[model samples]
Target: MKSGHSGWVLAIARTLDAYGLSHEDIFRQVGMDPEMLRDANSRYWQEMISRLWCTAVKETGDPNFGLKVARQIRPSSFHVVGHAMSCSATLGAAIHRFARYAKLISSSAMIELTESDDQLKLVLAFDTGDMPVLPETMDTVIAGLVCFNNWIAGENVPPLEVRFRRPHPADAEEYLRLLQCPVLFEQDEDSILYSQTDMHRPVLSADEQLASTLDNMAVTQLGQLSERFSRRVRDCLLQQLEQESEVSRKATAELMHMTERTLLRRLKDEGTTFQEVLDNLREELAYQYLQRPDCTVQSVSFMLGFSDASTFSRAFKRWTGRRPSLAQHNGTAEHA
Candidate 1:
């Protein structure tokens, strides 16, 4: 398969084949388009891909799609990146390197590592820029991270906390099962946090030569420009929006040291819109607020730049297909 979201569709076919099943059977059971599996590099919408995965799992009774895929990947396959990550000195460093070279594995989302006095966190912030087709991007990231870690440590190590940038929806139990850990929804960030001590635990190997070779291979396979430039733009937009409380296209362009027109054109060329990117950031922030019982809907509304509670409520409803009050009560809105 030619690796991409389209490739993932093919992976479903490949999975069925490995399981002594046919695509016709899988598609008929799952209600997905068998034609989608034919494309090599085609990208589906984020929500669509997630729905297909969920359907496949439910129809096939396979809860291990994510894990099975990760494990089947060979050393020379995308799994090589996992092998490289396993060789890192510490989990934190491994996550850092993963974020730095994620494009090699997939042009999906970038994993971010955040540390505070209380915990070490990994955030799999999605990139609308790449038009990622998985609505459960965070779920896959966390699952893949755990799978990768277990691969490296040769043991299961659950996260202390899991947070999603989006609201809770059906099939959430799969997340719980995959993670085997506490899960929080409507979080400000799509992240998993662990005790700081976990960061220091040595991984499978500390071999400098292995690490260096992996780094070189990662760069050779996945060019540095995509990851670096995307992160640079994303970070700038995030900082400007959070710190300055402004994220105008003009302002973002200036921050990127480019003209507004250039920025707009480039973003367009990359298949994303400024408003969509802004929404992704706002959604992440909303998840964070919901995770805090003390955070009020009114406060979150204003923080998201809604003119009033009603406006925020409507937007929230549109975003997650439920009223804000529901999310307030449940700490996570129902997905659309």
Candidate 2:
């Protein structure tokens, strides 16, 4: 699947150049044609991204290469999505929005937000079957989220903890120092955890009016992204779910420019249905919204498109086998 923007390849190039290494050579060595990344808006395959990371680590001889690469991400790297995030009302709100629109970043991977009693966990899960999550790539994502939030807040907002699925690196202390939090390795997932209360901390760059405008632009652009048919349908549901509007099969099909029957047939070939896709999207988003300290059951229910809180409550219970209110009390990561 299309993994990430060519801007990522550009970011890798810039990082390597900063370290006095020939990034173009590394790009070519990894079997990536330099011309493929010439257009910043074009996307490269996920396997190519993985291969580039593997090559970069070996040539640079730096276990901390991904951290260095993350530091180089400016707003331009993320385009309008970065603008929306920077102008969001709060750190948590920005991150939440990012999760909702993360298909803007990678088609094969998704960001999930969850919280326990005291900590908020941002989990990075990839859907690239049979493809291992590269440690270097994991570092870049975790570090990028940390760095971006701190940039948005205009101050260091250290995470409560950082967890990685990869084994400990030789330069683990760098992760600790940069994150200013305990960093654990070989965890069940790659996640960044912050105190639940830290989520409401106001962003210094926030301009809600501008943020609202940018968010609308993002939603329109999000639906236009080229991706798997099911994923495109899933993106449609995300917007409807966020607006508290019903995700009707007819509406979804219309958005995708296909007849309802054709859309359903395509989804079936993709091993899903419109209703199944909508329910899964809501369930995933429900955990993300419920985990935030500021979000209430009523607010979350509305955001997820249920007619009323009670209906959403029943659906949430069906999805999690427990109440959404109680999800925050459990330390275990809720699987979507």
Candidate 3:
């Protein structure tokens, strides 16, 4: 499942409280664990997070709910990536760094930077698979990017124009008031266009050594995150293999609160696939089961989700270049 840092959840909770809304009630209503807020390392599932945003918008009935929430965001909300951005030499460098480490915030969404002769555009896009992204969610993210940019710059670094994919709101006064720029709706993409001159301006908190250290940490964290995600998929598959005769990608994706396409994509990003993970896991289990004196090949076949002993033997041979019976007799067989 794609997840975001819990800091986002806390920021939203704080915003809801400021609006006299009960964040705990909203979290429960959306099937989210409110206790996740207490853990700094906890991640909120993408689907549950979208529900939280929708619920917050519906309950508050504020057209600028997302903007208000963005205003409440702090550097700590982004974890180390935010601090790294803060120490960037220039606005352009900061934005580039943000785009590079965007996955640290949320894997379901991406931020891209494009440049023209005199303007820079920060484009935002979400890949939630089959889930529909709410306008409020987009608003919070885009607005938050701009707010963070301004914060790091230590001055109001207004964008040249702000564009949204959503239709024009009934009242756009709040957007203009908060964005302080020409806001356009129904645009091809949700983006913030800034002048190149402004982007080249040096950041007030620029620290080369600190930025380098933070960047290295972010890279290491990203690697660890990928490993953790792969482990999560393996764990999910292990559980399903115990319960079902045949486990489909769709079923596993549903269990993970993501779409099959997303699951496949995430696995691909980790240099594997569902089938590969399943096969490898079964191979590992086959060896363990064979090592047990009480377990037979037929029983092990069934336990590993194979339909028959012959099929299991063929798969076992392919994995270890030896028959299951031989592997069992030999105590262990080296994998091919």
Top candidate (TM-score): 3
Residue-level lDDT tens digits of model 3 in 1-336:
577888877889999999998888777655466887887767766766876887799999987888888988888778888999999999999998888888888878678888988988889998886667888888888889888999899888889999999889999988887788999999999998999999888999999799999999999988887777677887898898888635779888999999999999998986778887788678767866776788888889889988888898888777655688775745554322
Estimate every model's Cα lDDT from 0 to 1: 0.62, 0.77, 0.83
Sort the predicted structures by lDDT, highest score first.
3, 2, 1
Q: What count of clashes does model 2 give?
A: 0
Sort the predicted structures by TM-score, highest score first: 3, 2, 1
Candidate scoring better on TM-score of 1 and 2: 2
Residue-wise C-alpha lDDT for candidate 2, range 67-103, written one tens digit per residue = 9988987665676777889999998888888787777
TM-score of each: 0.50, 0.65, 0.71
- Give the poorly placed runs of model 3, Cα more than 4 Å off: 229-231, 238-243, 246-336
Steric clashes per prediction? 6, 0, 0
Question: Which candidate's lDDT is highest?
Answer: 3
- For model 3 the local lDDT of residue 312 reads 89
**What are the per-residue Cα lDDT tens digits for candidate 1 across 192-297?**
7787777676787666578878888777756543443434566777687567467688888887889988877777776677776677566556645655677677
